[model samples]
Target: MLEEDLLYVLALQRVKGIGDINAKKLISHCGSAKNVLKEKRQTLEKINGIGAFTIKHLFDSNNLIEAEKELEYIQKNNITTFYFEAENYPEKLKHCIDAPILIFKEGNFDLSNRPIISIVGTRKITSYGRYFCEKLISDIKQYNPIIVSGFAYGVDICAHKAALKNKLTTIGVLAHGFEEMYPKSHKKYVSEINKNGGFFTDFWHNDSLIRENFLKRNRIVAGISEATIIIESAEKGGSLVTADIANSYSRDVFAVPGRSSDNLSKGCNDLIKRNKAAILTSANDLIEMLNWDIETKKEHIIQKQLFVELDETEQLVYDFLVDEGKELLDIISLNCELPIYKTTTILFNLEMKGVVKPLPGKLFEAI
Candidate 1:
């Protein structure tokens, strides 16, 4: 993305009353953020869902001023900005209608071929939750999945530490900006996380850490990945909300089953009983449901069948694997510009056709 275009996007983000859905609608109709901002009020009003009130705020001079300052901070600090329409933007997140038009990134971990899973739960985790969360990430270490969490106390921190201990990449999704770290004590771990993985936030620099932001942040936690795992929660908590968001996105949701009487277990158990989430007793359940683990072969290459008829989407994914030489399921979806679930189905069909095969860690290679 060009610097000028990004500036306009940042400015558009600052426009009060215009949320992501409307921002996207405006951008889609106008061509670019710059065009959206420059469009006449009458023209913008004619666009669907963009009401007169939103257009009233579109010409606010302070929006650009703040955007320029934020852009300067971004440039000086090496912060990465992800535009929703960019090829480099997260593929799964792109499918979410409410996903931020611009998100700030501060990390160095690669997402290639790695299944991103968000683990969220209560801040006051019990011994059982801690034990299960740590062990779960450790058990999946060999698969080299990217663990995502809210970076809070209890279950969130436990997930991050477990990922670090296993030498696996972990991402801390923040509810605030990089300028201020919440739960100040966790600041010590920031350097290490940045070195290994990194943090993601849609909030601008100097944004306040308020209560409502966490709910908004939960959507990112749920939207950015292929699935969400809730270790523990009270009957009603933010983690459950994340699970709901994940479900709304048609992403897999897993909850650790526990005794009904336990407070922390109630959320997970409720989710399971309500059929909102799968009962995740072990890592194997997740592995099987996601088709993330298949038999490991001695070699990566296989004899791919020739002259097999394939649809346009199947051919797209198959050609990508043949050309890319064994890519992850999510990576294939990203580069092929297909939804993750659709990519999974296409890969399954390709496997059935004897032209592709699944390997451990959700990898696929041309037969």
Candidate 2:
């Protein structure tokens, strides 16, 4: 976006009652934010859904003044802004109706052509949650996904750290702005995170941290990725909200199942029971659901004879492939009575053993 255009967009963002959807509508109607701001109230109100209340403050001069100050801050700090229509904006997030029109980014990582997933859960994470979160990232690290999460305590930090441990890029979606870091304790991870991935926020630099900011932040966490995973949540928590937001965007959502008696597992259980989220047990579940296994085929170079031993699970999949000749991933999973993710994992193992190979369109055959 041009600096002059960004100034108008930032001013429009500061306008009361003008949200992303309306901002977009106004922009579409008038060709640009600058045009919208300069248009007469009667001209703006002629458009559908543009009520008197919406454009009442649209022409406020303070909006321009404040935007100029923000522009100065952005220029001095070298902050990057993603206009919704720009090519640099996240592709998946752009499809979302309520996506922010302008999001301030402070990261060096790219969001293109890679599988991205958001991992969110309770701040009060348990030992099981921590273990599953860490192991999940480790197992899926081969796919080189960009992990997305809030930079909070427990599951959020755990996901980021696990991604770091696996040498994967991990992005933190901040609830506040770059002016200050929340929780203060997490300040230590900022430098390392930026080196590995970075941070994104729609909030201005001067925005203050508050409780509601978390709920607002959840939308980005959900929208920016191909899938959202709730490692663990109580019967109620912000992670559940993220799941809802992901579902609303028609994005895949997965929740790790926990023991029924566990408190942190309640929200995930509810999500599964309500059919709002798929039951997630391993990295394979996520991998298959998101079709991330397809990347392996592109990078495939190893071709081995059937000299490697097959474990029980791998043998089951291999045998099925042998009998079926060629089968879709879903068919293999159904016939083997394995979850799709588990089936994908088995197929990957079998491919490594050189007795199976993935065909086009997610088909697999015995080699």
- Per-residue CA lDDT of model 2 for 212-324, tens digit only, reads 99998999999999789999999988999999898877677889998899999999999988878878988877766555665553233223223467788887887786567
Candidate 1 steric clashes: 3
Work out the TM-score per prediction. Answer: 0.81, 0.81
Each model's lDDT = 0.88, 0.88
Q: Give the TM-score of candidate 2.
A: 0.81
Which residues of candidate 1, in runs, are more than 4 Å off? 296-367
Q: Model 1 residue 198 lDDT?
A: 95
With candidate 2 superimposed using the best TM-score fit, by how many Å does residue 150's alpha carbon deviate from the native?
Answer: 0.8
Off by over 4 Å in 2: 295-367
